[model samples]
Target: MIDARRGVLYPDRMPRFHRLPPMPEAQHLVAWFWIPEWDLGPGETSRQDVVAYPALNLVVEPSGVQLVGATTAATHRDLTGRGWAVGALLRPAAVPALAEKPSELRDSWAGLSAPDLLEPVAAAMDGDDDDRLLRAVAIMSRWLAERAGEPTDAGLQANAMSELLMTDAGIRTSEQAATRLAVSLRTLQRMTHRYVGLPPLAMIRRRRLQEAAQRLRDDPGIDLAALAAELGYADHAHLTGDFRTVLGMAPSGYRQEL
Candidate 1:
């Protein structure tokens, strides 16, 4: 579980026992909810189930998304930039609807500049008496809905896939993903490429490497070989190779920097 203060915006809680679905082979639009808070609980003890948003997330502080989990909860504090934020959730078929159209729906989704959406969101967040947050999300939802025909689109699908890959360590190839999706490998590849940018294998490797880096930073004494095995690497050397590829530094060096 996670915790939040009276006033702080944070990411949403990760869904447990739930997984994201596969991306469609067509274009789509996506929207995200951001919450902010004032004061949060002490660190090291607070935890929350956080579902990672698949696309680029615009995190605004002073006010942000309220992350709800099954057990723990906390308000997230702004560690970087100002309370105002604008970001993008770029994906292939999952482009923002504004860039494409009903005809292009089969090929790409629309892309939104966070700044465009942030103004309304910020106004809502700034008010003491306004349905600002709700209205802002509603506006975003309407915009996305008009573009993609669905509130959640290919971006969300890719996010769910990423979470699954991260949780399962890795899935080896698109064939595995296809099996899960009940689609052909080509179809799955196209969908993944459109919605996730990178292929499935690359995504899996990236997540594993990211996990390894975090482990090294938090606990240098973690057994490299075991860590490699846990992340589904062939061996420590293989894991080390990937670590170098993604981070441009060996795990040991990464730890040193930490």
Candidate 2:
């Protein structure tokens, strides 16, 4: 239930965060659903940092629903009051239904006009009972199934491309991704641009960066060069450069903070 520390930067200080698997009906559209609830006293604030996954998200709050695009860098949010949000980490098959030009929406979010979804989700979160979250997810699942419909042939191929890029450590290059997916380099690039809003190599680099950060967080005394080599980087400097570029700090600096 509690997803805890995959993309999270600070596992120890995270508020109440839960990750739920998508219902069977919506599996083609959603990777998973995430809920985070936080309650803080006056004058207190909690800042949550994340190396976000390279995918779009459909988020619902008390106010409304928003379609968030794939992020190119690390992100942080400051929580200052009592609140919560439910979000679906959307798969590539679902992107075209929500955003026609995925590249145009990169690093930004647009408001979605779906009052039918907002009402029941708000009602579910109003209660403190345990099953309320599940009830809310079920409602969202039905909505997504109706809105996105079924995947097309190209959409299914795009989904496979995304899965391979995110999960395969051997896939260090976009050419390799294209080869594994049985598509030309041009086709792979086109598919990712249309469905993922990012280059295939960017997705691979994101996965490697997330793994590097996790390894550093879990093993403070581990060798940096070894970590970089394991993650398919050229050397320690390449790893440090990636950290500084995306995380705004060097790997050693980040470890010191932890």
Candidate 3:
């Protein structure tokens, strides 16, 4: 299972962010929907840190619609004012359908405009919150349904390979990922690098670090040394180093924030 709990970085602010499962037919194309609404006091600015998965997103915000691509590393978005957003998180296999070279979109986003599915979604944006979200996602679903063709055999297998690496903690390291995918290590690396926007090890590390951050939020009192070892970190210092490097905060400090 893709652990939803481990996807977002700031669990303490859960009320401001949430995700909904995509319709079954859209699962192969869209992983889920992320909804974030925030009201900030004057002089208040909040930064949202995210350890994104090997996927893309269609984000609709107060500004406009944007097709957010896969990110090669961790990133943060600074939030201000009172605003809300609805986003469709695309799956790894869905990248090629949207962009020929997935890496071209890595860490970058493209703007969207009128005359697409955004019309209805944009029109419904001013209404009640629930209705707005429903109308928006429904239109998006219809749009994706038209292009939800099954990916190539290798793409499908690559998605399956990513799934195992992300969801199963037992499968650590690229070698383990190759074993799970029943492919040679070199083959898995090549496919993931070409289609997934990152090497298998990098993607695996991203998911692992996200999971670690979540655990820190959920149980701040847990032993960092044990947690580090459990998560395959070389040592306690290793865990802190990764936390600081990726999230810009030490693990202990992250837990304290929670």
Candidate 4:
């Protein structure tokens, strides 16, 4: 079984990410609940660079369901007091089939503005029973499967490429990617935009900035000029300018916050 906990980052004081082992029949879906330490307020809006997945996330504690998107990273803050969250991950193609539009799903099932689904979801969270949450996930899966059908191999490939564009540091150019895929540059660009939203170059810059942010957070001592060169920026000034544009803060300011 794939490790459901791998993608999650839990602070030291909280319970480790928890999940029921994947049953053979339901390997396509993974469900889990997390109760984070109540000490930190939500962190700054970290730019999550992810490819769009055709999945729905139900926030049980506050009660809501949202269609996940690829446009930007979801913002998160540390919550104080004990709180609970349950999330369900589904195949990517299932998303469009399940909702009228992607934005509609986000509107219906996220944050303080959730649909009536919130009440039951919150109730399930408050109770110790797993049946209710499991049932909800099963119902959603069945509904999506009926409408969306199973994911296609092409769709999976597209999704994989999209993820690599956003997260993989080594993937730097369309020419390099085309060489790997044995396709023309034009073909790669078109396919990437269709699946990943942003073009290859834009995605590369975004990923670099994200890495820079993480580095700043983890080590305040990284010199700005060296950091710029490390990320492939032409010069320190170029890095400074781009960092301000993407993060709304200077590199020094960001480092100080660490």
- Per-residue lDDT tens digits for candidate 3, residues 85-104, read 88888776666766676676
Q: Give the lowest summed-lDDT range of ten residues in model 3.
A: 6-15
What digit string (tens of lDDT, one per residue) describes model 1 on residues 18-132? 1111123221333234443333345422233222222333233334422111111112323322233322232333343333222232222333345555566577657766455
> Rank order by TM-score, top first?
2, 3, 4, 1
Model 4 Cα lDDT, one tens digit per residue, 1-258: 222332221223243334543333333433333232122335522222222222344334453555443333323344454555555554333344444444444313434344455555566556667475555444444444454556676556555554555555666676776676666888767665554344567656666666677666567798889989888788988787866775556788757644
For each candidate, what TM-score against the reference? 0.55, 0.97, 0.89, 0.60
Sort by lDDT, top down from the best: 2, 3, 4, 1
Instruction: Compare the candidates by TM-score and give the number of the best one.
Output: 2
Task: State residue 257's C-alpha deviation in candidate 1, in Å.
Answer: 2.4
Error of 4 at 146 (Å): 6.2
lDDT of each: 0.45, 0.89, 0.76, 0.51
Kindly list the per-residue Cα lDDT of model 2 for residues 1-258, writing each as its tens digit: 112255787878789988888899998888899999999999999999998888999999988999999988899999988999999998899998899998887888999999999999999989999998998899999999898887789878888888888888899999999999888999999999999899999999988998888998889999999999999999999999999988999999989989
Candidate 2 wrong stretches, greater than 4 Å: 1-5
Q: List RMSD in Å for every model shown.
A: 10.4, 1.8, 2.2, 6.5
Candidate that beats the other on lDDT, 3 or 4, i.e. the better one: 3
Model 3, residue 85: C-alpha shift (Å): 1.7
